[model samples]
Target: MSPSHLLALRPPPDIEAQVVAFREAHGVRDAAAVPHVTVKARSGLDDHLCWLALVPAVAAATPPVPVELIAPRVFPNGSALHLPARSPGAVQLHLDLLDALRPTRRFGYEGPHMTPHLTLALGRRDVNLDALLDAARLAFPQPLTFTATDLVWMRKPGPGGAYQPVEGWTLGSTPDP
Candidate 1:
């Protein structure tokens, strides 16, 4: 089976380094992976089809989104740790992409229910989550704001495979310097 594809915004290098350090300190295996906020998750689609759909969708997307990474929050079941973010622009882009790619989309988009976040780590149920949360609170006491300037297309070759970047699109009128 072909790998799934998703659109996401990666964090700036400084913040990304902090995220990597936190994950490594906690013994997470994928510590070196990029820190990103998932804009859309599309499953059951091959790379070629996803790319064809993304090209036009990206063209219509809004310019670079201003994002603020707030306090860390866990998922309902405490399976993941993430920094909550506020980005209306990102949300609009997501909705626009959904509309453009609806025909080829295999799953329903989150739409208005989307909660934008940058995942820090996925923890096991047996782990001491309270400690992790406390550490996270200290590590991310202040909010960090930055421009989300690009949308990255990522794909995994198969189940359990790591996602690899396939292509990218700049968000604003100005291209990357």
Candidate 2:
């Protein structure tokens, strides 16, 4: 199968470490995953020319986003835990990507449905969410803030494959007209 693709904003190393440590403490961490907020969800953009042509323009047009990762909470399903991020710029970028990459779009977590967040743990069974919430609060007692300066293009070769970054672009780096 052609690799599935997604765009994401990576948290800074320090913040990433904190999240990883919290996940490790609870034994729910996916070591292969990098801590990130999904700007665009999974899609079937298998053609390199498609993304290579699209991402540069969108990223250069978008400015760096300032993200504030607030309280950690589990989804209503109780299967995944995440740190919700507050960022208008990120949201706009997501909306822009949805329009630019409409052909390959497979996920609908965009526009009004979009919630920019960093997944802490996913697909765990029989875990106590309340305990996990408490632990997350302790680890991140306050909102973690950072400038999201780049967008990473991540790929997973097949179902159950690890998502590894394939390329990246610095936002708003285009010279002024």
Candidate 3:
């Protein structure tokens, strides 16, 4: 299968280090992965040109987004623990991207209903939700605040491949080659 592509916000190095440490402590399978809030989930993005064309314009229109991860919570299915973020700016960016990439097969989560979060443990059904939640609370007594300055184009080679950066665009600035 072809690699999947995604768009995400890379937090500052310090914040990322913290998240990595937390993930490692919690036994997350992707412990060494880059900590990010997925703005667009994995997909073929067959309209690659359309996304590339629209990103710069939309980015230029948007400013650095404020991302505040409030607290840790488990999904309704009792799997995956994440830190839910409240970022109106990020949400707006997501909506703008979706509209700009119109007619493309909408993949993964989309629209205003999507929650921006930093995944600490993803797709781990064997974890004890309550224990993990308690651990997260203790690990993060206060909210983590940061500004998302860049939108990264992430690509994963094949099904189990790690997502790596293909390119990035600074919010409100032009994209870099």
Candidate 4:
């Protein structure tokens, strides 16, 4: 790969294992193959902090806000806007992944939903978003990297399920200059 070329990365084993456990405990199914940062409410904003994880780049990622040729608009910019407010570094990457896999609506708001989060445990209703946020932050400063070049419709068991390595598709590459 050249200086301009980006290679895909895989989440470290520990991270993958944790997500798997969370999935099982919650009995989740149909998780997108890519990774994402599970977000939770923050101190000020009624929003969640993008947690640790990766997702497939349905489209190329916008730069790390600081390293952009032309920054996309947050609102008035339309699709040109690369990403919303991100926590810089890895958190930003997770945001990008979520941005790529977000479900698009028809004849409606015409904007991406702010729920840019990776589902840790699925099918579970009793989730403390606050607690989840703290857990992710504590594990932070974790320098990890992976290329989410593929998207998959995971088939994990239901009701405290298990996710198989399901099918995957390439999603291009992102090189961190």
Candidate 5:
């Protein structure tokens, strides 16, 4: 598929550790599977408070492609919907972070909206949500903790609303009041 737009992120080392810990704690080792404790949706996730940014971006950029998400959860779903895309004061912080880190956009920010979340999975019209739920239940039955400290800007193959970041923001850093 063609590349998507750009998204900035704040990936934390602890969050990565936590995901691995959660996966092992749940005893899941399937490489093809997502770690437990991440959020997911059956219909789609854009409507979720954490995912308000992604749905609108998709609608604006890939309106022709229908995107569906599942229920909300608090783990890095691997997608960006529920991954805490931005903090309470992300807009200002993002600008500050860029200045702080000298982070480059890589791909300029161009989307209907900028949503940041810990993505778990992507939605498809033909996906069987029941199966997804079953998988999620077996993996993460409880919540896990993670921290955000840095933002990662990635470059996709295309422009405007195509690409996404893993996690947007977290605690224990320069955050909003």
Candidate 6:
């Protein structure tokens, strides 16, 4: 069967540590998964060959995008809390990757618009939403900025699997390695 995969930009070390700490404090699962801002998620492509084709295209067309984490925002349905990310270059990179992978038609979210975010917590009915929001605000008060220099290819072997890094391509640099 075809593997499930996603393209993402991983957070820098310090920010990643904070995300892990928050997850641990709140008893969330999948804490080992790298903290990232997803570009495209769970595509239809089945194998590395397609990824092999797509990664080079993405790297060739993308430059290093500057990413800035803005304040925390809740998903409209209150299912998750996230840190909104802003970067024109990152948006453009998303569009370009979408174009390259258009044939797979694997884009998960519905929209002409993509709201890039770094998820802080998954909402649960048992948890007090307001309290979680307050804590998230305090945990991530200041804006954090970084250069999104690489695209990571992540894969899950089967249903309900943890995503693991398969490969990576550096933006505006040598071809996929």
For all the candidates, what are their Cα RMSDs to the real structure? 3.3, 2.8, 2.5, 14.2, 13.4, 2.7
TM-score of 4: 0.35
CA lDDT scores, all candidates in order: 0.73, 0.79, 0.78, 0.33, 0.34, 0.74
Which of candidates 1 and 5 reaches a greater lDDT?
Answer: 1
**lDDT measured at residue 121 in model 4 versus the true structure, 0 to 100:** 31
Which of candidates 4 and 6 reaches a greater lDDT? 6
Q: Rank the candidates by lDDT, best first.
A: 2, 3, 6, 1, 5, 4
lDDT of prediction 5: 0.34
- In model 3, the runs with Cα more than 4 Å from the true position are 47-50, 175-177
Better of 1 and 4 by TM-score: 1
Instruction: Kindly report which residue stretches of model 6 are placed more than 4 angstroms away from their true locations once superposed.
Output: 1-3, 47-49, 104-112, 124-129
Query: Which parts of model 1 have CA positions greater than 4 angstroms off?
Result: 30-32, 48-53, 56-60, 103-109, 125-128, 174-177
Off by over 4 Å in 2: 47-49, 104-106, 175-177
> lDDT tens digits, residues 1-177, model 3?
776777889889998888888878877665317788888775435535456766777777789999999889988876478899899988888888787767446644678888888887766557676787899899988999999988887777776676778788889986554
| Model 2 lDDT tens row, 1-177 | 666777899989999898778877788745236788889876635646555678778899898999999988888877567889999888998988878877544555567568899888775666677888888878888999999999888777776676778888899987334
TM-score of 3: 0.87
TM-score per prediction, in order, is 0.83, 0.86, 0.87, 0.35, 0.36, 0.84
RMSD of 1: 3.3
Name the lDDT value of residue 88 in candidate 4.
43
Candidate 3: Cα lDDT at 123: 60
Candidate 5: Cα lDDT at 70: 30
Query: Per-residue lDDT tens digits of candidate 5, residues 67-149?
Result: 12233344334322233332333444333333332322322341223343444444434443345545555554554333333
lDDT of 4 by residue, 51-144 (tens): 1123333323433212111211223322211112233433454345434434332223222444223433322245443454344444332433
Q: In model 2, what lDDT does residue 70 have?
A: 96
Clashes of 5: 30
Write down the worst ten-residue block by lDDT for model 1: 51-60
Report the number of the highest-lDDT candidate.
2
Tens digits of per-residue lDDT, candidate 6, 1-177, equal 546777778888988898889877876654235678877766544564555576676776688878998888888888777888897776777778777776446454622478777877666666565677788889889988988878888777775455777888888886735
